[model samples]
Target: EIEAVAASNRVEVKPIVMCRVTQVYETGACVYVYYGVNFFGVDDPLQLFFSIEQACVEVMLRHGAALSHHHGIGKHRKKWLPHVISTPSLRMIQGIKHAIDPTNVFATNNIIDT
Candidate 1:
C-alpha cells in the first residue's frame, strides 16, 4: 500500500522490512516498515514526502493497524490522533499538557494541540 501510494505520486521507494523488532501475537504479527525514496529530480520533495506519508497512514488505519508502533506521534501525525483516541481522552491529554506546561513552552503541538 505504501509503495503503491508512492508510485501514484511518481516516486519509487525501496522498502526495508525489519522483522527482528516484530511482535508476535495470538492473532498475527506486527512488522515494521521502513522505506527510502530517491528524490534526485523531484521538485518540492518535502511536499511529496508528506503526501506519501499521509497516504500510507490512511491505508494502515483502514486495515486496522495502529497509527504508530514504537515511534510516538509528532506534529506530522498529530492531526490523526483523534482518529485513534476518544474525544474525552484527547481532552484529558490536552488538560495534562496544559497543567504541565501552561505557557506552552515545551514541545508545543508535538502530540496534541495543547
Candidate 2:
C-alpha cells in the first residue's frame, strides 16, 4: 500500500517498515504502525510527501487501525474520528475534555466538536 501511494504521488523513494525488536508492554492484539515521510529540496516535494503519507494513513484506518498510535486524536485527524469512533463515544470524550479543560486551554482544535 505504501509503495502504491508513493508511486501514485510520484514520490521516488522506498517505503521503510520498522518493527520493535523487543516487547515493551502487553498491548494484546493492538499494534501501532507509524509512517514517517522525509523529503528534501523543494516545497512541492514536501507537499507531495504529506499527501502520500496521508494516503498511507487512510489505508491503515481502512484496515482497522487506529487514527493515531501515540498521541490522542488532534485536529488534523479529527475528520476520520467520527468514522472510527461512535457518536456517543465522541460525545463522552468531549464531556470529559470539557470537565477537565473547561477553559479550552488544551488546544485540541475541533477534536471535541460534535
Candidate with the greatest TM-score versus the true structure:
1
Q: Which ranges in model 1 have alpha carbons more than 4 Å from their true place?
A: 12-20, 25-30, 112-114
Candidate 2 structure quality by residue, lDDT tens digits, 16-38: 75544332456434455555544
lDDT against the true structure, each candidate:
0.73, 0.67
RMSD of each: 2.9, 3.4
What is the TM-score (0 to 1) of candidate 1?
A: 0.76
Give the per-residue lDDT of model 1 (tens digit) for 35-93.
66776566767887788788778877788777776677777888888888899998998
TM-score of each: 0.76, 0.68
- Separate clash counts for every candidate: 0, 0
